[model samples]
Target chain A: MKPVFTRPRSLADVSTHYCPGCTHGIVHRLIAEAIDELDIAERTIGVAPVGCAVLAYNYFNVDFQEAAHGRAPAVATGIKRALPDRVVFTYQGDGDLASIGTAEIVHAANRGEAITVIYVNNAIYGMTGGQMAPTTLAGQKTTTSPFGRDVEVCGYPIRMAELLATLVAPRYIARVAVNSPAHIQQAKRAIKRAFEVQVNDHGFALVEVLSTCPTNWGLPPKKALAWLEENMIPYYPLGEFKVPKEAE
Target chain B: MAKGKVVINEDRCKGCELCTTVCPHKILALDPKKINKLGYHPVTLTDPEECIGCALCARMCPDCVIEVYRE
Candidate 1:
């Protein structure tokens, strides 16, 4: 017998601190698998965000830099510029990228930095006790928005992938989900392609992954996956928003 | 049926029951009798012979707790 599936080499053997059924772990595995498949673990440098995945550096066996809340893009830009030969990527949550670090991410994508970004959007803020986030869907109940997010007052959720895709400088921009096995496989492919864009020196690449926050969402693990598919997918449709002409 | 088996790292599982939902054979279930160090019921295969090694459960596991082998 031969092992058909096992943990990727890029991922550390230790268990992650994520809650039960949190999709962050799935996304983490996908990124690690991408790094392994590309054979870039030795030269990969990950910028960890200041959200629930703050301890991301401990999980991935690679050189990592801790970025200030929402400053992962800025830190990644510096690293990629300083170490041109190294593969640079940032793992950021919606609260980190879409809220506080909005300016940093926008400018980084606008500048066309040769780095990959794995953006996890689980709608509500997970680490800070389920507060409403800029990406939180309308009418979605959260700690801050107990009455549910009102589009009229709180405004509609920001679609980061679409926002980044509008930028002319990005080499690739995609959105994927990890709610199911099929989606996980597609998400893995998109993550790998995002890395490929940087490896090929194709300016900036970002893959926004629609993840689940079972703890914050007040739902069981399985229901969270279904909620994400039924609610998040309709608003933030999954697909590659932009791709370099040659790669398309 | 394709001969295959899965090894669950009990300590790494958080009792999410995600693997059970995706298992085609419905062979995966949380071991009610045993709890891991994390205080969650660990997953176990009920009938090893039923596993086809499609790796759906392994793929769905967020913690990478399951390893699939095929013969």
Candidate 2:
């Protein structure tokens, strides 16, 4: 028998510490698959974020650097600049990217750095016991916002993909989900393209993946996927918000 | 029908049961009788004959515990 679907070579052969049904594992697998498909495992250097995936380096076989809370983009920028030959990327969560590391991400994209960013937006902060994050939807109940997020006071959830797409320096910006098989496949393509944009020296690229926080959301893994489709997708519509002019 | 087989890394599974929902043949289920070191019911192929090797279960699995093969 031919093995058709197995673990990606870029992924490590150990169990992850993610909670039962956490979609971080899925996103990690997707990134590893992209690295494997691109054959850039040897030259790939990933910057791990401070949120739940702080230990992301242990899951992938590529060289990794640990960045301070919300400093992944800055770290990645330094790495990419120092070693222009290496393929640099950052894996960050909503709290790291949209909240604490907001300045870092905005400047990194605005500066047109030749780096790939895997931004995982699960809305609430997962690593810190489900506190409200900048990307948390309005009226969403979180530990920090027990009465639900009030748009009047908290403002609306920041659509990172759309925000970055508005910048002229970015070569590509996409928003995808991993709630189902179809979306997961599309997410893989987007991630691969983000890396391709860097490989071609096209400038900065970011793929904001709408992920699930089953434990934080107080829902089972299966229902979390459904909830994301029904709740998150409408607010943050899925699609490539920006692409290189030549590819458009 | 295309013949397919699925292998589960029993220890690696977090027993999220996400794969059980996406299986087209519905051949996957949590084994209530057995628990892994993680203290969770590991997923098992309930009926291997019903599996069409679609790999949907593997794709949906968060932990990458399922591997699919085709004959």
Candidate 3:
């Protein structure tokens, strides 16, 4: 019998530090598979973020650079500018991308940086033990907001995919979830499209993935996925918010 | 009418049941009596003949521990 499913070549043959039930592992596989399928693993440079996926550099079998918290875009910009022939992508979580890195991400998108960003939004801060993040739902309960997030005081959750799509420089921007098999397939397609934008020499491209944080969300691996489907999907609508006309 | 199998890297499994939840066949279960290197129960196929090699479990596994094979 032939093996139908195995680990991708672009992924390192080792274990990841992600918590059990965390979809970060799935997202990593998706990105690695894209790189392998495109045959760009040799030239791809990933900028690692300072969150749950901080050690992503160790998982992917490509050249990697470490960026400060919320500075992946800036770091990626430098890398792309210095080495235009290389493929550059940033892996960032909601806390790293939406909060401290907000300004950096917006400016990078506005400046039309030629890079791809794999944005993982698990609502709460998983690496930091369930703290409220910028993308956390208004009524969600986190360690910092034990009483549930109050929109009046904390402000509403930011819809990043919609917010970034308003910019004209972005060649592609999409939001997808990976709770179920169907969504996982869709998420992989979106990731491939994000990379294609860069391969075609297009401007900024970002794929926002709504991931599950079972440990931080206080749910079992299975229930957390269900919670994401039922609660997170409604608020963070999924789709390609922006796509270049020719590619659309 | 198809036969399949699931090969698990028991040492790598973190005992996350994401794959078990998505198995339409309901043939995957964490071995209660067996513990892997990680101290967590590793998921295993309860009945090899029941596997359809759908690969949904492999897709859902965060650790990439499950590999599906078919004839």
Query: Could you give candidate 2's per-residue lDDT for residues A1-248 as a string of tens digits?
Result: 78989999999988999999999999999999999999999999999999999999999999999999999999999999999889999999999999999999999999999999999999999988999999999999999999999999999999999999999999999999999999999999999999999998658999999999999999999999999999999999999999998998
Off by over 4 Å in 1: none
- iRMS per model in Å: 0.5, 0.7, 0.7
Question: In model 2, which regions exceed 4 Å deviation?
Answer: none
DockQ of each: 0.90, 0.88, 0.87
The B-chain TM-score of model 1 reads 0.95
True-contact fraction for model 3? 0.82
- Pairs that collide in candidate 2 are none
Model 3 error, position A75 (Å): 0.1
Model 1 per-residue lDDT tens digits across residues A1-248: 89999999999999999999998999999999999999999999999999999999999999999999999999999998889999999999999999999999999999999999999999999999999999999999999999999999988999999988989899999999999999999999999999999998657999999999999999999999999999999999999999888867
In candidate 1, position B25 carries an lDDT of 85
Model 1 chain A weakest 10-residue run by lDDT: A196-205
